[model samples]
Target: MPLPTTLVWLPETVSTDEEAFLLAAHFLGESLDGLSLSRDPLGKPYPARQGHSIPCLHISNTHDGGQRLLLAAKHENLVGVGLDMVYLPRMRSPYKNRAYLHRLAARFMAHVEFERFQRAAQQDDEEALRRRVAAHFSLMEAASKALGTGLKIGAFMGHSASLPLSALGALQIEPWVQLFFDDLAKTRLVTLKAQRWEAYWGSDDTYLISAVFLFGNEQSKQALQLDYP
Candidate 1:
């Protein structure tokens, strides 16, 4: 069967990451009604029942400053899904410092990504550059999570080194991502709508959250249908 097309979002009300995860699980259990939840050896959550092979319902959650987001899906065979969220920093924030940004790029981004960030920083507004970098990192984190390898050992790590930014660029399309699932974990570029909500500091803030759904043995170009605003 095709992967689940529905993507649900819960409001931000939790104080910590653990609380956010619990809220997401609660929402998922309620959404599925009778489905029971279980965790694998690695701590990934899924739906399960007795006398039958448990169907894989990939779940990923992220939180920042009391805001939480979750992405979930049930893929027919077995597929991996990942989710990540980030707070978009304002231009006056620490992230806007070139040195700090470069440090992050060196630590987590590939050469190509660093170049892209440099170019964007030179030509675009600080806010735009921040969003671009945050979005890229979120996607990379999501893909890594989907592979159950995290960033340290997944596609972000290339040839026993950090994965190249060009590799991530190649995954901007569904087919390429699917083809390189073993390495890239099916990460594709999709519309990420910025969300605005009141922060714990009693001020309005913006966030950028992303998800990578559908990584598996099968090769398909189909992209998940996500509706967010």
Candidate 2:
């Protein structure tokens, strides 16, 4: 972890797909000429600076109809990093099919958190509540990916949407996740930051972008910004 800075940037666009690519270079501080360096085979960003060996992870995502893209990155042998951006328009009623969003939320929440969210759902509009719940679930999924294991194995598969509140509560510091944090601490890499912003596309479409950065000794002192014409 020689370099200790994590930079994140988001841009508004009329083209949802393009926004994903644009944010990648902007966050990496590279020109179009360095485009190839921003993504690995798995789409994670490689650390900048030639010959500088450091572990780096990055992710970018956009919802099916979203006008904005969310980007994330970390250095110092950072583990998995996942970012998900969904258009508010795409959220549907989960009660009709409590599979996708419901399952995701169930896997991410602690017992108390799940109960609180569930109570809120009972009183709120079903569609709106689904969006909120999905957003939260996605955030946790992103955070979990940043710590490694992604959302494919372990905690993810072990838990389902019907998980008990008490069981969800126990997820705060699971042994596997704890071990990841321990490794970061042992290596003196212990910085975490999150950002949220709204982006406009073509004056008609808009979406929100949330980003998280994880690093340790090598961190930037200033917020990263990139200009897109």
Candidate 3:
């Protein structure tokens, strides 16, 4: 079966994290009141029942500007999953300025990754560069979240070796997506497979959405699937 992932777009007036949950409950055809939810020590939400875990389902959520998206995977054999969405505006103007951009690259990017961003930025116009950087950041964040480490340990691990600047410039999803699996193998941070989806909302709004599945091994490349709109 395909990955049970779902995306929900919320209007500006009603945008909230809770809406994602509501959509999940709707997608599952269950009333929100019937589901028991709990958070781990790190504050990630998961499904629970009578203080026991629900092993069959995994969920992750993210929001950007006025839009919210969720990923719900029903896996009889898989483990954990993570989702992330980044707003295009988050990486625009002052945020993408030289000083701020350099700081962000230093914080989350390895030296080689930073170099690639630099090269790409020099070649592309400001808007294109901003979108690429935002998407990269979103993917990294999604991977980290899938590992249950958030940005603490996962972000610092070396990813540039797998996700080179050349892949980003190639503008091909397959090559770019492969880098996530490659990074997982090289770092062994967590055994997971990742896939990303990009969406354009309004005339001016764009988002980079990513998901990662955990406990996935070599065969995961074949088992994992992504649904994009």
Estimate TM-scores for all models: 0.60, 0.46, 0.65
Higher-ranked by TM-score: 2 or 3: 3
- Candidate 1 collision pairs: 156-163, 158-161, 158-163
Top-scoring candidate (lDDT): 3
> In order, what lDDT does every prediction score?
0.48, 0.40, 0.54
| Tens digits of lDDT, candidate 3, 1-229 | 4455555555555454555565675786645655666777666677765667677677777776767667766665556666778777667766567666657655666555566567657655666656556656666666555555455444555333333321121122233352233333334343333222221211246666766666544434443222111
Q: Which regions of candidate 2 deviate over 4 angstroms?
A: 1-23, 26-35, 38-44, 48-59, 66-82, 93-104, 120-122, 153-209, 217-229
Q: How close to the true structure is residue 174 of candidate 3, measured as C-alpha lDDT?
A: 31
lDDT tens string, model 2, 1-229? 2433333434453344444554564656645443333443333344344534235535545444623344545454344444545555455434544455556566666555565566556655655555556555545444443433234345545323122222211121211111112232222222333221111111112333333344332243322221111
TM-score of 1: 0.60
Candidate 1, superposed: residue stretches over 4 Å from native: 1-6, 11-34, 51-53, 90-95, 116-122, 152-205, 217-219, 222-229
lDDT of 2 at 24: 61
TM-score between model 2 and native: 0.46
